[model samples]
Target: MLPQERQKEILKLLQEYRSMKINELSKQLNVTRETIRKDLYEMEDKGLIKKVHGGAILNKANSETNYDHRKYTNYIEKKSIAKKAAELVEDGDTIYIDYGTTALLFAKELMSKSDLTVITNSLPIANELVNYTDFQVVVIGGTIRKNEKSLFGPVANLGMEHLYVDSGFFGMGAISSEAGYTNFHMGESEVSRRMIKHSNKTVVIADFSKFNTVAMNKVASVDDVDVLITDENTNQEALKELESIRTRIVVAEIVEDEKSVE
Candidate 1:
């Protein structure tokens, strides 16, 4: 078969199922694994797909923005929350960062801290701390969730059991008086639950928008969270309600940008 035809077939298969391994493609296409690998690499460079550890997945950028997009969604708010959350960390502390956009910001904030052990299921968070020699980074092994670019499943939960930390910073999809804290993805939620159980203290970092929105799974309750960090945009009424439940709330002051006034 012609190379172009083979590539087209591969694209068709990926479109149907979203992802496929090189070995699977080889068997399906009656091609050698090396040939399929080369084709996948070429497709990845062309922006036709994304290459995973053992396979290729249809690019989900248009449907779901990757970590970079999420990291910048509420840039100012996230930065403020991260900054405040960082103050809770002391030198030589062990921390478990859950996989979420907000937790990714927390990892960035921790980049300057020295002599800390960081455990996480977030690839982006782990990569951010890679250059910091003083910080020890450990990643949990599990089934990688393509949309979120994080690890989940039993393996990841098992990896988390090996260590207890001073604090665990988590991000929630929604926070409400009724539902408490929830997540959109079930696999991710399971990992978050494990992290909360393994930590001495649990801090939840969320933006103002997350209030009142409930997702698929509930990770914890208002009582489970030791501290709640958010930006100034958070509603005063919600803050009062949170405090009533004995959840300490910290609102980060926003720094206005003067250049926009011109």
Candidate 2:
């Protein structure tokens, strides 16, 4: 990888792990300890990471933006993940769509399907799916998280009671072997837990960036998910972690648009 590309991967790792030893980064990125040290030095000079005694930690100043802002960050990758996830849905199936940018894209991917029921707390997802004549969109009501534009709380929890689905599709803040599946928002995590409880199958749709990361609130264990759909760029170690737990990993290939053959 180019120096810049390697540094970007290092930043992503630090963001997920919070901190890392030089040797750890070297192993994960398949580089030498000296190269990791040099990358840390450059990243520190750029104010993206802080070089510690033997490694580096992400600079809080370089953290991600709000929910709406993140929707555009990894557009193509998320779309590809969403598309692959949508394929798992058969017509006439009932499924729960969790609240997140990727979940919203998954909702859009389902627009062409017929006779489906979508359960969601995300206003964007419900609004998008409701337009489809063949879809039955169920909105879980609760206190609104304005920034995320999703609902979660006791009322939403109550809404989940006695309701069940064939499958539950979720988007997580992060996933790792040690941390399992987690979310940054506690309320959303609870909602995800309840959805997983009521569904026959659980599918997590997350981009490669979410792999190997741990978030603030626990949602589910790695083995709790039946299938995980991610883009091709997911880290090898993270994939191995999922494999160890027996969570089915589906890597979505990013297909490029075909050019004119002439």
> Which candidate has the top score in TM-score?
2
Write the residue-wise lDDT of candidate 1 on 225-246 in tens digits. 9999999998888889888999
Instruction: Report the error of model 1 at residue 185, Å.
Output: 0.6
Candidate 2, after superposition: displacement of residue 107 in Å? 0.5
For residues 50-131, write the lDDT of model 2, one tens digit per residue: 8989888776544545887888867888888888999999999999999999899889889778899889999989888776
Mark the regions of model 1 whose C-alpha exceeds 4 Å error after superposition.
1-66, 257-262
lDDT of 2 at 5: 87
Give the C-alpha lDDT of model 1.
0.82
lDDT of 1 at 13: 83
- Estimated TM-score for each candidate: 0.73, 0.75
Best by lDDT: 2
The C-alpha stretches of model 2 lying farther than 4 A from their native spots are: 1-64, 258-262
RMSD of each: 12.3, 10.3
